[model samples]
Target chain A: MTLKRLLSERRAAILEKWRDRVFACYPPETASFLKREADRFSNPVAHRLTEGLKGIYATLLGEAPAAEVTAQLDEVLRIWAVQDFTPSQALAFVFFLKPIIREELAGELKADAGLTAELLDLESRLDGVALLGFDVYMRRREKLSDLKVSEMKARISGLLRRVGVDPSTL
Target chain B: MSLPKPEELARVNYQPPARGWMEVKPDFRPGTYCNAASPKWLEWIDYPYPRQWSVAEEDWQLPENWKEIVLEGMEDRLARFRSLKLFFDICVRCGACADKCHFFLGTGDPKNMPVLRAELLRSVYKRYFTRIGKALGELVGARDLDEKVIKEWFFYLYQCTICRRCSLFCPYGIDMAEMTLLGREMLASIGINIDWAMASVAQCYDKGSHIGATPQAFKDMIDFLAEENERITGIKTPVSYNRKGAEILFVTPSGDYFADPGTFTLMGYLLLFTYLDLDWTFSTYAAEGGNFGWFVSHEMGKRLNAKIYHEAERLKVKWILGGECGHMWRVCNQYMPTWFGQVPSFLEVPVSPVTGTVFENARVHKMVHISEFTADLLRHNKLKLDPQRNAHIKLTFHDSCNTSRGMGIFEEPRYIIQHVLPEGHFFEMPPNTIREKTFCCGSSSGINANENMELRMQGGFPRANAVRYVHERYGVNHLGCICALDRATLPTLLQYWVPEVEVTGITELVGNALVFEGEIERTTDLRDRDLVGVGEQEGGEEEE
Candidate 1:
C-alpha cells in the first residue's frame, strides 16, 4: 500500500465521523469554503479538515461568532497538552479514531481491493502528519507558556519596584 | 538483562531491634472487653494512659495535686499561643474532607474522621476559651475541661499524620493538620507528650535532625552509603561535609542519611549532581527537612525551619534542595515562604543546567524538593538514563500526599518518570487517588504510637488498596514514591495488609539505572536493593 493511498482512506474515515459535528456548527459560507478547500486536494483532506474544522466549529457554535475561538480551542487543546500526552496526544487521538473509522469503512472497503490498499496507505501517512502537527503545536505552546522565564522576570521586577530600584539602572 | 542467581547474593539479617516499652498482656481481662469489630465510642474516662500526665505514678493517685499541676502547666503563654483562635474557628465541618482522610477511609472508624478529630480539640477549646462555652458548659452539651478530656485530646490529636489532604477539600481552606499540631503542642505543654513526639523534638534540638543519630552514627551511615555506592557504580563519590560557597546546598531528611531505600535514593541524588558537575554541599546543622515541630506546634515548626535558613546563611550557598521526604517538602514548600520573613535576593535562578528548564516559584533561598530538581535536570538532559534498570518491574508512582495534593507538584515527578523509565511501563494509579486526591501513609503524624496503629492502618487502607488495584490491573509490582515517611511507613503497613506490592523512592530506581565515571559491583539480592517489597507471612494482621 502506498502512503498517499493510506492517508486518503484515513481522511475518508475521519470525515465520516466528524463531518456532521463540523458541518452542523459551520456556517454555510464557511462550510462551502471548507468543501472547496477539501475538494481541491486530489488525495484525502481528513487530517487538514479535522484540524481546521475545530476553529470553524468554534466560530459557529460560540456565543459570539466574531469573538476569538482561541480561548475555547485552548481549553480543548489543553485536555491533551500534558507531558504524557502533548506531542503524542493528537496522533493518539487519531489512532483511537482509526479503529472506529475502520469499522465504519469495513463494509465499503471489503468490496474493493483498491480501497482497502488505499486505506492502509492513508493510515501510515496520517500517523506521520498527525505527529508532525503535534510537535509543531507543542513547541509553540511551550514557548508561549514558559512560566519560569516569565515568572522570574515578573518576580524580579516586583522586587525591584518595591525597593525603589529601576530596571533602567542596568 | 539477565536475572541474578539466588546463590550469588549476600544474605542480610535485617530486623529492627525492639525498643523497651510496656506490652499489653493479651490474656488479661478487664471487667469487660469492647467489641473489637464494632466501632468503639471513646469515653472521656477511657483515655489511654491518664497517669502519664502526673510527675510521678504515686502522684497520679492524688487528684488535687495532679489537677493543680495540670492546670498550672496548661495555663501558660506556650499553651495560649499554641491554642490559637484561628485554628479553632476556621473549620466548617463540611465532611468534604471525610473521604480525603486516609485514616478514616481505611478504618471505617469515626474517630479517625477529620471532623471528629478536630472536634476533640475544638470541643475543649470552646469549653474553656469562649464566653458561650464557659456559660453553657454541660448545659449546652459541651463537655467541661477535665483530666479525662485532656487525655482524649492527647490521644486523638496525635492520630493525625498532618498530611493536609483534608485542607485541600475544605471550602474555607482550613488546615485541620495545623490544628492537630496546635493540639499536640497544647498537650505537650502539660507534659502529656508521647515518646515518639518528645524523642523527635529532642533529636532535632540535640543532633540537628528528627531521627537524632549522633555525629558518629551519621558518619557511619555516610560511610555505609559510600561503600554501597562503590559496590553499585564503582565510583568513589566525594561527598564533602560543611563545604563553604558551594553552588547548591542539599538538605534531606536525616532518615535518608541512615535508612534503607532512603540511603539509596540519597545516593542517586549525589551521583546525579556529580554527573552534572554541579557543586552542592550537605549541612551538618540542617540535616533534617522533616520538621517534627510542624506536627507539634507553630513555634517549634518555625524553630526547626530556622535551622535551614541559619545553615544556609553560614554556608553561604546559592540555593537549597531537599530530598524525597514528604512532610519536609510540605514544611519548606508551603510553610517556609510565610515563616521566613524574606527570601534571599542574590540566589541564582535554579536553572537545571542539564535541562535548561528553570523552576520559577520554587523557594529560592531555602529549598527545592529533590523530585522537582530531578525533573528539571532530566528535562535539560543532565543525567543519562538506562531505562532498562526499571524494566524488571512494572512501575506506578504514588504521589506523596504532601508533595502532590499539598504543593501542586503533580507534573514534575510524573515528568521525571515518563522521561527516565521505559515507555508503556509508567502506569498511574487511578487519577482519583493520584495527584490532589492522594491518600496518606497512616502512621505519618507520629510513629510507634501503638494506641493509634488501628487508626493508622485504617487511614492507610485506601492507599494500600489503590496500589493493590494497580498491581493487579497493570502487573505493577513497583510503587515509586518521593516521601521519606511514606518510604518508612507505607511498606511496613503493606507488609501486613497488602503483601504483594513493593514501595520505593523514585530516585532508587534512578540510582540503579544511572551510569557514572566508574563501574561498581552489582549485587542481585532483591532485599538488599532498597526495594521494600512486602512478604506474605504477615498478611491480614489488623494494624495495632
Candidate 2:
C-alpha cells in the first residue's frame, strides 16, 4: 500500500520479465548459477553470483558497466576470500541490492487483493521516483532518497514560480 | 617589427552561459519510471529543439514539390548502397562502443553513446526504407518518420566527428560515423541543411577555397610569406600563384592563407619546395584543398571536389601535393579517387626532383604531405637549420587524427621534428588517444560553429586534458600538429581550457627553425609566445 511497497511490486514484475530474458540469453551453467544465487540471498557466495547476474542484466539492457564497477567487485571478492561471511556482508550492503529487494516486495504487495487500491496509489508515487532516478542515473548515479527529495523540491519550486511566488523569496 | 609574446596573443574571451529559457517542473507526475516497463526511454528523447536555420527565404523553398523528389531520391540512394543496408542490419545493440567514445566518456550523456547516436539515424532508415520496420513499428521498437525526428537527426548527426574510433571496437566493424554522414546526405536532399556546411560548400565553389579568400588574398598571403621567408632565411623564396606548367600543384586548406601560424607553415612548405627545386605552384583557383562538404553530404562533396580536379587539369600539373590539413588529405588521399576518375598516370609517380626517389603507384597522384616533403628535404640536407631558434620552447607533435589514422603519415612529421629541432622535446600522449586514435579538435566536423559551442566544449575537453597532461608531464610547451583544422580549432580550446599549451602546424615550427640567408637577430617577442608557462603544477595525470 505504501510507495515503497508499490515500487517493490513493479520491480518484481520487471525482474520476472528480466529473468526470463536472461535465461534465454545465458548458458545453462550461468542460468543455474543465477537461479541458485537468487534463492540464497544470505550467503556471500550466493550474493556474488547475484552480483554477477546484475552485471549481465545491465549489459543486456545496453548499459556498459564502468571500469570502476569491475575494480570494486574484484576488491570486494578479494577481501571476502580472506574473511568468511565478508562476501555476504558486503553483498547485503551492496547499493544495488536494495532496489532488487524493494521490487520483489512490491510484486508481493500487488498480489494482495486488499492492498490493490493502496497499491495503485503507491504505484503513482513510485512512478515519479523511478522517473527521477532514471533521469539522474543517465547523467549520474545518486541515492534513492536524494533523488526523491530533489525531485520534490524541483516540483515545489516550479509550482511556486508559475504562481509568481518565488521559492527563493520564500 | 616584432610579434607580441605568446602571453600577449589575443585570448578567446567568449563563453556561453546557460540561459533560463526552458523550465523543468520537478513535481509533474509521469507514469512509474520503469525503464524496462515503459518503452518511452527506449524511444529517442528529443530535447532542445533545433533552431530554425537562417538561410535566404528563397533557399527555404522546397525544390518544386521537393517532398516527392526527396522521397524518391532517398529510396534510390538507400537502395544503391548495400554497405548501408548491411551496417544497419548487423548491429546487435552491444554496448561495447559506449565507453570507447570520447564524447560519451567525457559527458556521460546517453545521447553521446555511439550505439545510441547510431540508432538516431538507424531508426529512421529502418522505418522509411525497410519493410520489416514498417510492419512491426513500436512492437519492434521503431518510430514513425516525422519532421521532429528529422530535426533531431540533424542536430545529433553533426555532433559526430567521424573519428571512426568506435569502428575499431565494434565487433562487426560497423562505422557509426559513416552512417551519420549518409543520414546527413539523405536529410540534405529534403532541404534540411546546416548553414555552416552549406556556406563552406558554396565558398569552395565560388572562391576556390572553403574560407573564400580571393586570388589577391592568396597573392597577399604569398607576399607576406616572402617577407617572412626573407626575415627567417634571408633567402627570397619566389612563391607564385596560378603559374601554369609547374611540375606539381601545391594545395593547402584556406586557413593557412589568412591565419598567422598557418601562414608560417605555408612559408615552410614554399621554402622546402624551393630548396628541393621541385617545380610546384600554388593555384589561386584551387587554393583550398580540404572539402567541408564531406562532413555535410556527398553531392556537395562532389561539387566542392570538382574545383580541385578542374584546377589540377587546367594547370596541367603532373602531381598535386596537399599541405598538412587533416580531413583534406583524407578526402584527397582516400575519397578522391573513388569520386573522381583515376588520378592521371603522370601524377601517379611522385619523383622527388631532389633525390629522384619515385613514389610509385600514387593513384591519388603522388601527393605528399608537407611534413613528408620537408622531411625528404631534411633527409637530403636541403635546408639550413638552426635548432636554437626552437630552443625558446619545448616542442612535441600531436598527430592530427586524419593524417595519422586516415593516411598513416606518422613518421614524416616526426622525421621533420628530429631533423629541425633535434634538441626539442617530443612527448607522446597515451598510445590509444593519440596518433591513430587521436581525439578530434571537437570542432572538426564543421558543424560545431558558434551555435553549438557548448557541445563543442564538452566534446573537446578530453583532448584539451590530454595536451595539458603532456604539457604537465614532459614540460612540453608547444603542441605541433599537421592538420589545418586542428591548427584552427584546437587553439580556441587551448585558450578556453588549456591556455598554457600553444598549438602550431608542424611546418610553422620547421619554418621557425630554418636558418635564413641573412642577418642573425634573436627575437622572442612573438605573439602567442609564453601565454601559459610549461609544466605549471596542477591536477596530476587523470585518465578521462
Candidate 3:
C-alpha cells in the first residue's frame, strides 16, 4: 500500500500521540488541564491546539495549498508566542509530528524503498509546516512589539495632538 | 551543535513534579515579569531602600533583612485588617475558584489559579505564623519564606488583576484580590515593586496625574477636545479647570486625558456637561481618578487617594462626579470614604443638578459614577438623544470587573445605552462571562505595562475568547465598556485576537448619539468617521 493510505489508516493514533506530545510541553498540571478540559471557551489554549492540529494534519495529507497549513497553525502558534516558550520551543511542535509518524509507520518504511522515498517527501512537507510556523510565530512577536509601541504612543496621543506633534506622522 | 533527535525530544514525561509547588522556583523569563522599580522614582518619592535592580538578574539586590520585613509587614497587615485576617483563616481550599481566574484559564499556569495564588502567601503565613504549619512543615502545606518564595510571590501576585471574580465562587467568599493586595504590600515592604505601578504613583504624587500631564497640558487636551466637539456638533463645549465653587468636581483617570477612545469618552463628558450647563470644574490637582497606589500598598493608596477629597474641599464643590473607570470607582465605592477618614464635611450628597434626584445610593460615599448620573438624566428625559445615530454599529457591553463586583453597577450603563442606542443594537457577551462573573481585561490593577504584553495577552485570553464568540455569531463591531483601563488595554487585545471588533467607552457611544439643539446635520461620530446616513437626512423625516 502507498504511504498516504497507511497514514490515512493510522491518522487517529498519530493525532493522539501528537496532541499529548504538544501538551507535554506545558507543566504537567497545566498540561493535564489543557488535555482534559473540553469546553472551547473555558479551555481555549487546549481547544486551539487540538483544533489547529487536526486542520494541519488534514491539510498536510490532502492536496490543499500551503497557505492552508499556515492558517491552521496560526491560532496554536499565536498562543505559544505569548506563552513562556522560546522560538525553538514554540516551533518545536511541527517537528514533533515527524517522529510520531515515523514510529507509527516504521514497519511499512523499512519494507519498501518506494515507501521510504514517499516518507522523505512527506517529511519535507512537514519541514514546510515548521517554516510556516516560524513565520506565524515571528509575525506574532512583531505584532506584540507593535502593540507595545502603539499602546504607549496612544496613551499620550491626545496630548501630542494638542501639542501640534501629530503622532501618526511619527 | 546538534539538537536532540525528534524521537528523543518527543519523549516528554507527563509526570507531576516530585517536589511540591513550594519547591518550584519561578523562571524569571523576559516577557513574564514587569521591569523592576526605578530607583529614580523611588528616590524622588523617598521610598525606602532606593537602589537599582533587575528582575532578569540572578540576584535581585534585596535588602538584607527582607524576610523579616515581609513577615513583619504581613503580621502588621493581618493584625490591622480584620478582612485580611478573616480571609487567611477562612479558605476551605474547595478549589471552586481554581478555574475562575482569567489568568489561570488563559495561561493554564496552575499558580495563576486563585486558590494557589493566595496559597503562595498562605503557605508563608502558615510556616511563620501558624502552630500547625510550624509543627508539621510540608505536611501541613507550609514552607519557609526563602528567596524563592519571595520571587514566586512577586510573579503570581502581579499575575492577578484583583478582579474579585474568584470571590464570587468561594463559599466562604474568600477575596483573592484583597489577598493579592496584601501579597503586593508585603513585596513592597521589602523594597520590591513593579515599575508600571510605582512610576505612575510617583508621577501622580508629583505632577497631579498618572502620565505626569501638567495643568496646562491637561487644559490643552480639553481645549482640543472642545474644538473637535464644536467641529462635529456646531456647539462649542464649555470647560473649566481648577475653578472654585463649582457644584461638582469631575475626576477621571489620567488615561482619559491622553488615550484614544478614552479621549472620545472625555468629549462625551464635555458635551453632556455643556448641554446641561452644569456647574462643575476639573481639578488638575485631583486629575487622576485611577489610584495606581491602590495596587502597591494601602498606605500609599491612601496617600494618593487623599488628593481627591482635599481637592474637593479646596474647590468647595458640592459633590464629586467621577468619570468611567474600573478600579478608581472600586476604590471610591469600597475604600475611599474609609481611607479619607469620613466623607468631607464641605461636600454634600451628590444631588443631580439637572434632574434634582438625590443620589441616595452615594449619600455616604458622596461621589457618583457618571453612568448613574446619565441614567438618572435619561430616566427623567433630560437629554435629546437620537438612538438611530448609532445604527451603523452593532454593540456589546463588557462589564468592567471592578464596577461589576465592587459596586454592583449592572444596570446604569445598560440603561444609558438603551436610551442612546437603537433598541436592538446591543447584545450581551454571555451570561457567565459578564456582570458579577465578568472576565478581566487581564491588564487591570497596574499590569497594563508594555514590557509584559505576553502576560497581558495570556491573561486576557478568556475575555478575548468571549469577544470572538460575539464577533463571529452576532457580528459585533463595537465592544463598549465603562473602564479607563479597559479602553486603554482592550483595543490592543481585540486587535490581536479578534481584529474585526473594536473597543469603545460607553460614553463615546453616548457622545455619538447626543443631538445638539440648532446644530447642523450630523456627519461624523466623535472619532471623525462618517456616521451612516445621518448627514444625508437634512430635510427628511424627523428622527424623533
Candidate 4:
C-alpha cells in the first residue's frame, strides 16, 4: 500500500500518539485535565487542539487542500504562541507527528523501497507543515506587537492630538 | 541515521516539581507580568519609597524597611477594616472557591485558586499576627514573610482581576477581593506598583481623566463624535462641558473619549441626550468615573473619587448621571457616600428629567446608572425606539463583574436590551456564566497592560469560551457590556479566541434603536457599520 493509504489506515493510532505528545507539553495536572475533559466549551484549549489535529491529519492524508492544513496549524499554534512556550516548543507538535508516523508504518516502509521513498516524501511534507507553523506563530506574535502599539496609541491619541501630533501617523 | 531519534528532539516535562506550592518561587516569565511603577508616576502620586524595580530581576530593590512597612500596613488595615480581619480569621478551606477563579480555570496554576491566592496573604497574616501560626509554623499553613513571598504576592495577586466570583461560592462569604485589594495596598506601601494603574492614577490626578484629556480635548472629541452622529442620524447633538447651570453632569470613564467601542458608546450617549433634550454637561474635572484608586488603596480611592462631588458642587448640577462602568459604580454605589461622609447638600437626589422618575435606589449616592435610567425610560415610553434598527446583530450580554456582584444592578441593562432588540436576536450565554456568576474580562482593576497579554489571554479564556459557545451555537457576532474597561479589553480578547465575535457597549445598540423626531433615515450604527434591512433592496448588488 502507498504511504498515504497506510497513514490513512492507521490514522486513529497516529492521531492518538500525536495528541499525547502535544498534551504532554503542559503541566501534569493540566495535561490530565485536558485529556479527561471532553466538553468543548468547558475545556477550549483541548477542544481546539483535538479539532485542529483531526483537521490537520485528514488534510495531510490528501483529503483536503494544503491551505486547510495551514488553517488547522493556525488554530493550534495561536494558542501556543500566547502561551508559556518558546518558539521551538510552540511548533514542536508538528514534528511529533513525524516520529509517530515512522513508528506506525515502520514494517511497511522497511519491506518496500517505493514505500520508503514515499515515507521520505511524507516526512518532507511534515517538515513543510512545521515551517508553516512557524509562519502561523510569527503572525500571532506580530499581531500581539501590533495590539500593544494599538493599545498605546488608543490610550494616548487625545493627548497626541492636543500637542499638535497626529496619533494616526504614529 | 547519524542524528538522534525524532521523538527525543523535544524534552517534555509534564510533571510539576516535587516541592509543595509554598516552597516554589514564582516564575517571572516575560509576557506574563506587568512592569513595575515608573518613578515619575510614583513622584506624581507621592507614593512612598519611590524607586526603580523590575519583577524580572533577581533583586527587586525594595525599601530597607519593606517588611516592617508591610507588617505595619497589615496591622493598620486589620484594625481599620473589620472585613479584612474577619476574612483572614474565618476560612474552613472547603475548596468551594478553588475552581471558581477564571485565572485558575484558564491557567490551571494552583496559586491562581482563590483560596490559595488569599492564603498567600493570609499565611503572612497568620505568622505575623496570630499565635497559632507563630507556634505551629508550616504545620498551620503559615510562612514567615520574605522577599520571595513578596514577589510571589506580586505575581499571583495581580493575576486576579478582583472580579469577586469566588466570594459568591465561598461558604463563609469571604470577600477574597478585599484580601487582594489589601494585599495590593500593602505592596503599594513598599513601592511595588504596576505602571498600567499608576499611569492612570497620575494622569487622573493631574489632567482630570485617565487618558488625561484636557477640557478642550474632551470637547473636541465630543464635537468629533457629534459630527459622526450627524452623518449617521442627521442630528446635530449639542454638547457642553463644565457648564454651571446644567441640571445633570455626565461622568464616564475617559476611555469613551478616545478608544474604539467605547467611543461608539459615547456617540450613543450623545444621540440619547439629544433625543431627550435633557439638560446635561460633561465635566472636565472628574472626567473619569473609573476609580484607579480603588485598585491601589482605600485612601487613594477616596482621593480620586473626591473629584466627582467637588465638580458637582462647582457645576451646581442637580444630581450625577454615571455612564457605563464596572468598578466606578462599585465605588459610587458602595463607598462614595461613606468616603465623602454624605452626598453633597448642593446636589438633589437624581430625578430623571425626561421621565420624572425619582431614582430612590440612588438616594444615598445621588447617582444613577445609565442602564437604570434607560430602562426607566423604556418602561415609561418616554422615547421612540425602533427595535428593527438592531436586527442585523445577534447579541449576548457580558455582565461586568462589579455591576453584577458588587452593585447587583443586573436587570437594568437586560431590561433596556429587551426593548432595544427583537425577541430572537438576543440570547443568553450559559445560565451559570451570566448575572451573579459572571466572569471578568480578565484585565480589569488596572491589569490590562500589553506586556501581560498572555496572562490576560489565559485569564480571559473562561469568559471567551462562553462567548465562543454563543458564537458557534447561536451565531452571536456581538457582545454587549457596560464597563469601559471591558469595552477596551474584550475586543482584543474576543479577536484572539473567537475571531468572528465583536464587542459593543449596550448604549451603542440603544443608540441604533433610538428614533429622533423628523430625523433622517439612518443607514449605519454608531461605529459607522451599515445597519441591516434599512436600505437593502432584494436581488441587487447588496445581496450576500
For all predictions in the order shown, the interface RMSD in Å is: 26.6, 24.8, 2.4, 3.1
Give one digit per residue, the lDDT tens place, for model 3 in B201-314: 999999988888898888888889999899888988989888999999999998887988799999999989988989999998898999999999888889999999999999
TM-score of each: 0.63, 0.65, 0.94, 0.90
- Which candidate leads in DockQ? 3
State the DockQ, from 0 to 1, for candidate 1. Answer: 0.01
lDDT of 4 by residue, A1-170 (tens): 78888888888899988898888776665677678767665566787888889998888888988889888997788777877778878877877787788788888878877888787777778778888888999998888777778777766654455456666688
Residues B157-255 of candidate 1: C-alpha lDDT, one tens digit per residue: 655777787777878777777677766665644445555555576677777877666766555566656665666677666676678898788888876
Specify the poorest-scoring 10-residue window by lDDT in model 1 chain A: A39-48
Docking class of 1: incorrect
Model 3 CA deviation exceeding 4 Å by range: A1-14, A63-65, A102-119, B1-18, B533-544
Could you arrange the candidates by lDDT from highest to lowest? 3, 4, 2, 1
RMSD of each: 22.7, 17.6, 3.5, 3.5
TM-score of 2: 0.65
Q: Candidate 2 on A24-132: residue-level lDDT in tens?
A: 2222322343354332211223333345545533432335444334433432332222222222232322323334433556555556666556544443433333233
Q: Rate residue A53 of model 4 by lDDT.
A: 93
lDDT (CA) per prediction: 0.58, 0.59, 0.87, 0.86
Q: Stretches of candidate 4 above 4 Å error?
A: A1-21, A36-38, A61-65, A95-125, A156-170, B1-5, B10-15, B343-346, B533-544
State the lDDT at B35 in candidate 3. Answer: 91
Q: State the TM-score for model 3.
A: 0.94
Compared with the true structure, what per-residue lDDT tens digits does model 4 show for residues B1-544?
Answer: 5564434554344345545778867788888899998899989989887888788889989889889999999999999999999999898888888767888777767788798898899999999899999999999988999999999999998998889999999988999888888999999998999998999999989888877778777788878878878888899988888999899999999888788778889889999999989899988887889999899888899999999999999999999999999999999989999999966788898998888899998888889999999999989988788988888889999999999988888899989889899889888998778899888899998999889988898889889988988988999999999999998899888878887988889998889999988789777777656777545653365576
